[model samples]
Target chain A: MSETGVIHDIGYQRYTGPRLGRGAGIGALYVHGLRAAFGLGRSAKAKIFPWLVASVALLVAVIVAAIKSQFSEFTFSYVDLDDQLSWMIIFFVAILAPTLVSRDLRSNTLPLYFSRPLRAADYVAAKFLAMVTAVWLLLGVPQFIMFLGAAFTTKTGFKGVWHEIQDLVPAWGYSLLWALLFTSIGLLIASLTGKQAFAAGGIVAVFLMTTPVVAVLAQLPSTTANHLAGLTSPITLINGVGSWALDGSIGFDIGRYGPIYAIEAFCLIVACLLLLLARYRKVSAL
Target chain B: MNIIATQALTKTYGGGVTALSDLTVQVEAGVIGLVGANGAGKSTFIKIMLGLIAPSSGSVRVFDIDPVTETDKVRARVGYMPENDCLPPDVSAAEFVTHLGRISGLPRTAARERASETLRHVGLYEERYRQIGGYSTGMKQRVKLAQALVHDPDLLLLDEPTNGLDPAGRDAMLALIHRIGAEFGISVVVCSHLLGEVERICDSLIAIQGGRLLRADRISSMTTASDVLAVEVSDGADELAVRLTEMGLAVTRDHRMLLVPMDSDDAYDRILRAVTELELHLHRLDQRRHRVAELFTAKETVDV
Candidate 1:
């Protein structure tokens, strides 16, 4: 035996166990992306913004509930939950969409992801779903807390709770729609650049710039062109969808536009989805 | 069986620069070194084999599964350590490696278990919890390597694994790579432009130049000893060479050694007698073996 070439057993064990396939791989990315969206499993500084926004949003809900409990004759309900917190939702997503998607691209870690047992479509779907779920939680938690508060504090107690449940169900449904709408547009814009600040700024600009333009256009005698212009802003579309999904009404008088505005909003949603898919598809190749 | 095989693989980018052209090769299961200089198409070939990119006109197979068509299957069975730094700086090595292990289809508990084991094997156990942004370059490379091994894939494609390491770090990494292949029996293809390190660590070699296959063979065959014997003397190598030449032996003088053609049965006796007559102390004597640098010119004479 040669003294120099004797190989030492370094405990490099071969894995002979069961290995999951593509579905499990995609699930792992989904879970990892979900944690990243809220800045979990990262630096302490990374955890600050998302948690702060969540706390502030929840505090607002608590304060609102506290104020509502004072007046027994108050008829305030949960249907307007999204309206009160839409700006907060916008801010949360502006910070979060880039946190989930742009960091991977900016660090050029897509190749690390794509080189695994994951497909390009699966990766995009995982990121999109994570962002949607994040936005849902960001919006849903406060709504849920407020729902419990309103249910128990009412004068009629369980009866008021039963009545509030009826309204809360559709409000929950509207919040989900809000999640899908905001995440789709936010992730689509965030995927355009690898720079996180740029992606965040761009998302904020897209939301901030178009709202006034939509408001100005919606005032032009409620014309067909004006109603169509309302779909240009993602927030207006979210509001239109929320009103339609919750109260069966359309914002910016879009109902007179004969489903054209809704169709355009749906088309815009589809376009954002397709753009996100295409962008990650290109990244997977890199 | 060949773990990876490519048939006339070619790739051309948008700017009409050909990264690889007419490349055909087969790699067996062992520590195979890809020896080449920069821009020699080593990375392109690796990316193609990993199913990360498609060839312009050819096919590739990893363990007889086509990488282009069966990417998930191929990638599931293969681990890749890329040439570039591709780590998220905010995450610790433990979290990153475990997440990648799960992404490669290991169950969560097994992923975590294997992550620690792999990180320990890569000598990063002590600092696995530190954020990668604060890690030194060597630590970051080990993190990248740890992630690749966390899944325990059948094959590992390491592109420039020693790209930015100091000499000691490079030595430790090469030793770890050597042990991984020797002890665990996982096949490794270590891509490097340094001939000496590759020669030290790899069992087989594939040399390419200008995106073309220059030579592929067992490291032993490529480095077989030549017919010349190198003789080193303590005091006077020049005097030994002159005396050996005067004694009708074909000898040439190198810096501190004399090269003599060992042809006849009495060659050793003749050289010994000449050195004895000169009363010179012999330092060393051995047959001259070919080095990997000889492959550059050896290909011109031998058909690969």
Candidate 2:
């Protein structure tokens, strides 16, 4: 600019400063990756999660009171045996993951991820794992305390949380196991679409909305419905936890110790792998 | 040798919307400009090279590595500043860069040191400790660039780095890009649609339209340099140009000026003789050089 402030920058030069090497660069990117991934997750929690989690918690609290009332002796069907908490988890996954992942992709904020040393798979892993931790903190902690209390009160075989874990190893393990499954599934669905609403709604429609109708419609006199309330295969662990909490015996129909855990593990792993592959495809396209 | 190369890298999304197609190009060193109109596939081609998007049926390589097969490795060598303002609004620039430096495998002390140096380089040292949410557009842009460079990549890919900046900010950013290539020894791919701006900085330029490579050449070489001269006259301009043309000098009339392609002292003397004979008052006579702006007209014929 001249003295009068009439700007003239014709001889301008670009930056030529030294930077990090490749090996060290990737490490820098990881730092960027974690902050970015967790930052988005935290923002989502602040914006959207309160309503879903609080509403569900309120419903569960009401049910807790209702069940302790005159309905104590009444026996509902196996379908009503659980309070659709698994479905609630599924709902949260469907809505939350898409809003978090897909919307960013659709709007072409991809450079936000790629510019750092962050890998596509690492981004996927961070998002998926963070979701798992989030669900565990929000859902598992509350449900786990209630489980230990219920187990001790019933005096079936355990005394406290520690005793309950030893006596009812099947319950807590399955609870965390389901948390992993739902988190992975949510991320997988979100990875495919570019819009949050579409991904979340698609998850709801496929696993929760249509899967249940299909299972129910598929049920017949000689034919048994495979899933109850479309509990994402991993949700059986929640059923396992609910079963142990209400009753003293934690083991189930599959076997004395082997519930549908292998199925849950298998699904969770497959979901994670699939999401990674999809993330790779997306990254390559960028 | 070209550090980044693309062979007809095409991308057609669902519903037949083509983001990029047949975009064959090459980039060697220095500050290269990628200029196009909005939705003109500058981002698409960059994404392909970054391995962030897969071309429909083509390929891209960066630093002797297939961006697809060696994405992690490729990303290691490439730093990117996106077009959009997308920092996590709550994080400090220093915090963000240090985190990325760690991810790029920097030791704790080095990451912190590198973050400070980068923020300083981008002139954001005062605001580096502040959250990005409160930063002005230019400060935010510097933070974006700081993260890209904190890792010390070999190439920097900046998408519309000057977007939303006032004149001063754009000039500062452009100067930084040039310096990165020349002083930092880092090749840069700076994307912009403003020909006047990129022409001033980029050593080379590539124009894209309708997902296709429209043109690629050095900004210094694209115009196929002619011996054209810009001549302005204070009086009798029209008569002077006519006299020069009649004198067998290829004189062309341009707005408020005349273009004379004189080759020898004799040819120059002939034009001077014509001007003197016509009694025209000459204001200035300057050589015309090749510039990216000169070929913007050619960019119109291709699809975006």
lDDT tens readout by residue for model 2, B1-304: 9988888788898889999988778888889999888999888777777777667888888888998777777887888888886676656788777776676666778778888888887788677877777889888888889888887788999999999999999999899888878877889999998878887788998888667777888876775545577788897887887788788778888899889885655766676777777777778877776455656675554433
lDDT of 1 by residue, A182-220 (tens): 888998988888899999899889899998988787777
lDDT of 1 at B201: 82
- Over 4 Å off in model 1, which ranges? A1-10, A72-75, A154-159, A248-252, B227-229, B233-235, B246-250, B261-276, B281-288, B301-304
> Chain A TM-score for each candidate, in the given order?
0.89, 0.61
Candidate with the greatest DockQ versus the true structure? 1
Which structure among the candidates has the greatest TM-score?
1
Task: Please give, for every candidate in the order listed, the TM-score of chain B alone compared with the true chain B.
Answer: 0.89, 0.87
DockQ of each candidate's interface versus the true one? 0.72, 0.22
| A125 Cα displacement, candidate 2 (Å) | 2.0
